[model samples]
Target: MVANRTRRLSVRNISVVILVLVVIYALVGFVGLPWWLERVLPERLEKHMGWQAEVGDIHVNPFVMSVEVLDLDAEDSDGEPVVAFDRFYTNLGVWRLVTGVVGLQNIELEEPYIRLDLLEDYSVNFARDWQANNPPAEDAPADDSDSAEPMRLQFDRFRVAGGELLFRDFSQEAQEDFRVTPLDLALNDLATWPREDSESNYYLLAAVGSQTIEWEGDLSIAPIYSRGFIKLGGVTHTTLQHFLKPYLPYQLRDGRVTLSTRYELQSADELFLTTSDGQLDIENLGLGLAGHDDELLTADRIRVGDISFGLNSRNVSTGTLDTDGVNLSLYRDADGAINLLEPFRNEADEEPADDSSDTDMPFRWTVAGVELGNSSVNWRDEQPRTGADLSLTDLSISVDELSDQLEEPVNYKADATLGGGGRVVINGQATPAPFTLEAGIAGSDIVLAQFGAYINEAANLDVRDGSLSVDGNLDLDQQQDPLTGTFSGAGEIASLDLRLGDSDERLIGWQTLRLEPIEYNVAPARLEIGTVTLAGPTVNVVRGGDGLH
Candidate 1:
């Protein structure tokens, strides 16, 4: 009986002590702490941060080790909002308070509005604060070097909800005025201490002009690392033209461009972001040049597979790039200038130095391969009345090892059907510099009827009927200025007939014509023909007095 009575007293006394402690903590947190902070923090923040600040109400519950700051607002000197929040919340560990220190386990900024801007002179409103917080080595004190004793702040989880951000830049007044609004983001499981289970993850969504952008990914703080994906969707077509017009030298009359990209990032060093993997999709892109209604370039779809790039050090690599339903028109304008070359004429090519001592190379790109499907092209000249206009349809090309470095030969194989049911095959390997190439080109059943109109317009002549068959193999070298190349081919034109442009009367006819074993040299501008054969050739000489010959 005595032992049981003593046990009961001890339990009661322990419960009583806990109850008293809870009450005291409640008094301090719910009443005393809130009141004190509301009075002191608001006054001190404005003076210390050099900004206008306000705090509506503060709430603390030491029992739960939580704090809530409500209706906080801050503005810059220009009366623009630096930050405003409906509520700011934080979670603290109760046991940690015993050490007379505050450690935050989590923090949340709810319905926050943050505004950032850059002026014409490339100055930002928060430049000073940002520089102070992230100082360069030369500007920082020697003692606070990279190996210094690290500051300890336990912020594990951070979250933002119903947040909005506006970013603007006034750099290029005419074209560089940019803005994004109604930004929303969320971040969770950010830990300073090492965690083996998982990693920090985040998601951000925003609107830029008429486009919507979204990103979701993982991130870490110490030894900073990140791995995530970003997506951009719902971009309007006309918005692209308006934005691109100022950057290009040519006028863009009209175009329809839709872009959607999903990118994956895995940084080897955590600094170069582009050296990763991703996909790019562009749809219904059409570009037309000035002074004409003809399209310069058109494509139904362009997609890039796994991609990696690091322009900071000029290292880039990409997987297969596929383009579908593409149509390109290469034309010479009335001024005897090719439309394709005009764009590059205005672009200043970076001149290379003579040696490594004078130059820092900036290009080291590698592409695994490229594939084109169901494409077509038209090559024409407008300067000549009857210049050749050739069309290739159902075109496909497979290219491999296209790199800026000559370490590997670029290999390509292509096949295309002529407009009138003829087909051609081309296969080649070439080096970019100290140029060398070995190629084979073969075509069959190239009906001359396809060129009837071209000959009529260009040479004031007509093609009655003809077909061509060609087989060729060539080797070319541009390594030396003299430019050496050799080709062995035999081509035959059969059952050919010709007439004057405006008349259907036949002037000449041939049963067969062939050329074989041809060679060419650029330095001397000469053509070597091993043999030429003609059979059953006939011509009607219309004498001055002749009527219909």
Candidate 2:
């Protein structure tokens, strides 16, 4: 009986010990742990980062080994919001600890927001601020040992939903804003540990204004390789014009671009990137000169297809480029410089630092074909006369092949109608290196009245009303330093009326004046005229401004 009583006493003591342990666990996990975290986390973060951090609430679940932080806000020194999130949750997978891997069962972030600014010198605000606030520590003595092993980490699933990023650039004179809203990201089976299946899958979806962006990819970190498909749908020019402001003086008034590409990247001894099956389309593009109402360039559509590029080899190739209904306006100022090219001229004046090493690895690019249809160009020149305007309409151009290597022949053709009921055609095959061209040029009923300003500027004469027709074949070769070329052509001017520039007196008149055949050769430096025919011709002798005749 005494032994039984001693056993009962031992059992009672064990039960009391178990009850005390339960009470302690409940107090720490359910009551004290979250409060302690809420009080300490803000202080720790501010002390280390020099930024203000706020935590609304923290909850710990002992049963699932999970923790949740709600309503977290982090701000910069200037009280600008850097990062804020509504809810962040993570669950610990304790079993992975046996294999020296810190594993996360699941991690979720909801409604996270980030704000970033880029400065004029291309430095980002967050980085500059952080570096300024936290100076680097002094160098320590080097240890004669191998570096510490990298921590191994694994995540079964990670997700972000309803995220937003506000990006602003102060690089330009005015601030530019770009926002990505409702960004969703997901990743599965991501691990930094050695495993049979090391590849992770990821998907991203986001929108900027009306544009939608999507990316889905498979990545592996051990070997550092990734393959992905990316698409940008209906990105408008207004949303992206700020990116081009530095390079262009014009404003993008209207345009939308759609692009899709498949890409693969590998990081080994040298980084390499390969892209294929790319397509880009631009629709309804209109570019207007800054502070001007008229469009400088406009296009209905431009399409680029079958694009492929390799970064390691520095090669790029495209199958076809097609553009339709393009209209361009070009202007030349009194200084004999194109107004549209002023921006590029200014940029060129700021000479780039020479890098001779880059010359050894030149880029190789080629386009299989190019086609432009239903295009027009309006040219205005303000030299030696009140601005003369010339227009070429209903233009179509085609190039069969073009490449950086200039050894091969490129075949091209162009056809256009002049402003006043005339047509011009040119077809040619050209080699760019030694600069050789064999071509035929023809024009019919080109109006001479429209060329009065040029005639006055060159010869001090005015062309009132006339029609010109020409058919020519030219073979030009610049293989030698001096030009070696031959031109054979026949031309006719009919119903011609000309007058002196200083006075409204007729100087010359002609009807159906023709040169039957004309031939010129560079080798012998000679010109041969076959014949001249004139139906009616008249001329008047006029004294020049110098009073010679």
Candidate 3:
């Protein structure tokens, strides 16, 4: 009976305690909690961020708070604008209000734009100003400060659908200058108070035209720093390297960058570029440079189907270059301009020497061919000391077509001379002139009647399948008024037939003529055949120099 009474009394006491606790929870949640929150929340946010904010239309059952901003702007103590947002609507997390934590569920901004002008010299100064005015709360200190305890602001997520951040004065004039237009940014998975007094680590994704860049990176809101090392492919701009410097490390300014595809370049193609492993020191910041350091403007190793030539250069002003395997060296003056070629001028070292008599100059020349080997001419004192061996190959000359309607044409094979002594060599078929005929003319027929009329008065003669063959001495004497020569041949003519063709009939027959001597006039184009006797059926006359009819 005692144990039952103790157990029943204990159960009755627990039921009374639970009923009081339930009543208290209901009063705070559905009735008075929202009223107290509306008065207390705005004060806390204004004291923390130094910005004016208003909360309207609070609901307690479903736990919702609608925040509306009439005007919002932040400036440095010097009154320079940092950021501004106007006419904003956002929904707050009701659970956060109950837990005494400030959190937003959804934030919708209507046409907000930010202007950021970061000059090279004033960046650090602006950072200092930002630190001083927005001092950390007593409970949370700023990250960049030296204090052991740091301030932090925590947030679940934040989204901005349409906005623009205009950055001006991002680079020096001579370095890599650029401008970014229409900036739209979105962040996800953001937690502001990541560590003690530290900024958030977020997943960032942004798009510029067709190119989308994404990275898992960390950003510190307190000290204002962010870094995302990522690969951006298919961005085809020759000046992209110059434009990406502000966001990248200083070392990448002169570092090696490997491009996947070759960029078509304008102007002269040859260029030498140095991009080895190096450090870039910009405004006292060190950065690592990586990628290819050679000529950045070449298609040398590109995978194009057919290999074509291209030019690449590092120093366009004064470096050597190669285009399609042709090597060329370029030079420039001190002013960084190309040095132009100068005109021919007399030099001080080439002044004329005092002299009267003409001095003998010595010259040596070598000539050789298949039949003649190693022929040389050494001229001393204007006279040729010549020993030349010359071989004549495929040398032939012939006159075809003797009709009045047609002009006689002479055709000859090309000849090459190799070996001989002296400056002249008499070889091959004998002609009335000093010129040599090739061996191909050995069996050609000769009509003396046509030749006699063209040269001088000569006897009627005929040679069938006969060739004029002569091996003789050639004398060239330019010291006299009229230069002359003699050509003698000892070849027989077969079936000799002679009758100068009249206007009536075409005289045609073969005749044998005796060997004769021909005299040639070197002054003018003339030839004189000596007296000849025809031996055949119409052996008409043995003439001194007359035609036989």
Candidate 4:
């Protein structure tokens, strides 16, 4: 009986050992199953989703498993290639693997390159093709209502360490149009849903070395929309401003832009803007008809203030110009060839009138408080070398060129105030080159010494409570070298005085020489004088070739 019992015990022990071995075999085989399973898993998925798939060698250990892709090139229904992955690997959860559960711990894609082509028609059918082959479910709606919910694509971590995205619009043929190059983009937060309807928006931050572009804000897939504010700080202010200028509604090729504000849209072909403070440094600006190649009018610096501007009928117009603090320097190259710098006090060149057969050209200028302290303009050829040291306050001048003889002579006027507390009024016709005058001298001493010197003569002059009126004509006739003209002056002298030449030829007396009763004329080479007409002059008159007579 003892022998039989011992044998029974051994048999029971053998049976228990066999059961333990079977369980161990099951566990070991299950844990190692993914090695064999992964080989065919990718094939099954490809067939199911209508994608071409290939797999690399699979690595398996008791605790971990990994599967890598040797190559993958799949196409959507549109036959557009999606992505090319150099190497892709996935790590399996060892705990789940031992229990027969199916899933991966994490998947990693290394250097996956993708190319997308967007058309101008705004149709994104490539995505539709991708979805068709890999349908989500029968209950899924046709429209992208789920897209509003947000899109999340996750991975252990995807790195585009070195890759490029080529996007092109094949429809454009014009060279002047905009084109986008292959931008190297390193993306993160791809797994997070991009906010569409939420008040808080989503963003993508990317960098290429020192240069960085942060594209933050809301994005909508439907209707194809995007709205965001861009703050560019990394690059130099000049370069950044230049790159941003093209996006502006107005062209600023030759201008110093201090600050600017702009708003734009896709559908609307118009742009609204407000400029804070800026100056345009342009040699010349042209404005004309759309197809007409010639420039209708031109100016030196076209300034728009802390100046508001608008584009209407293909012409740029200033809504409000703040000229109080703005200054524009203009240089003109006349003769269309001669290089010259003409700094005008003010200039405005408007478009030629459309209806009027003969274009009416008018120019206006204002030189407030012009201080000509010892300034001179010298002419070499028979032209007068003009020089003056006078201060003119509030000088305004306007000239209009007419085609036909008008009811009134071409309007010309220059108004200013002299430094001697006297108001100067000058009004004349534009045609004869406009003659002006200086008047209103009361209780001021008139110095006739310079006048006498210019005419090679001497005279004693005094004016008390008197009026000095001057009138002149300017002839622009080219026949005469110096352009002959006449200038006349008359003044009232309260006390009479007389003196001519030196002491030997001087005629000094108590005779009253009325200032108003005297007239003077200057021609090409002759100085003519009218009667002095004093009330009490019994003096004899003398004449010489070069002296006052």
User: What's the TM-score of every candidate structure?
Assistant: 0.72, 0.89, 0.30, 0.31
Off by over 4 Å in 2: 1-23, 120-146, 194-196, 244-254, 287-295, 344-355, 358-362, 502-507, 522-525, 538-549
Which of 3 and 4 is ahead in TM-score?
Answer: 4
Highest TM-score model number: 2
Q: Write the per-residue lDDT of candidate 4 for residues 1-549, one digit (tens) a residue.
A: 999999999999999999998777666645555456555756664555455544544444443565555455555434555556666666655565454444455555555555555544544435534556676788876886765754332332233334444444333332121222223333232223333434223444433334344444433332333444333223322333344543433233232222222212222343333222223223333333223343333333323332223322121222222122112212222232211122121223655456653325532212111111111111112111221223334444444443323332455455555443344555555342332222222223333232333223222332212323333333323234554444444444333334543434335343344443333333455545555555554354677789956
Candidate 3, after superposition: displacement of residue 106 in Å? 3.6
lDDT tens string, model 3, 1-549?
A: 999999999999999898888777666766677677666655654455343445553435433555455345554444555455554666667676565556666555644555565556647434545465478689884576665544332355565545555445544554332233233344543443434544444443444444344444456543344544333333333234456644533222222222221123222233322221111111111123244232211211111111112233311111111112111122333343321121112233586877654434322211111121222211112111211112222222222212221122223222222122111233333232333333321222333322333222333322222322333333333334565443333344555334443322224444466545555555575666666656653423343455633
lDDT winner between 2 and 3, please give it: 2
Which candidate has the top score in lDDT?
Answer: 2
Question: For candidate 1, what is the TM-score?
Answer: 0.72
For candidate 4, what's the RMSD?
17.5
Per-residue lDDT of 22-118 in model 2, one digit per residue for the tens? 8888779877999999988888767666679999999998767899999999988888898899999999998888989889999999999989888
- Residues forming the 10-long window of minimal summed lDDT in candidate 1: 254-263
1 versus 4: better TM-score goes to = 1
Clash number for each model: 3, 0, 31, 0
Superposition error at 131 for model 3 (Å)? 6.5
- List the candidate 4 regions with Cα displacement exceeding 4 Å: 1-67, 75-81, 90-107, 131-158, 170-549
Per residue, candidate 1 scores C-alpha lDDT tens digits across 511-533 of 99888876665556677878899
Q: Model 3 scores what on Cα lDDT?
A: 0.39
- Superposed Cα deviation of residue 491, candidate 4 (Å): 22
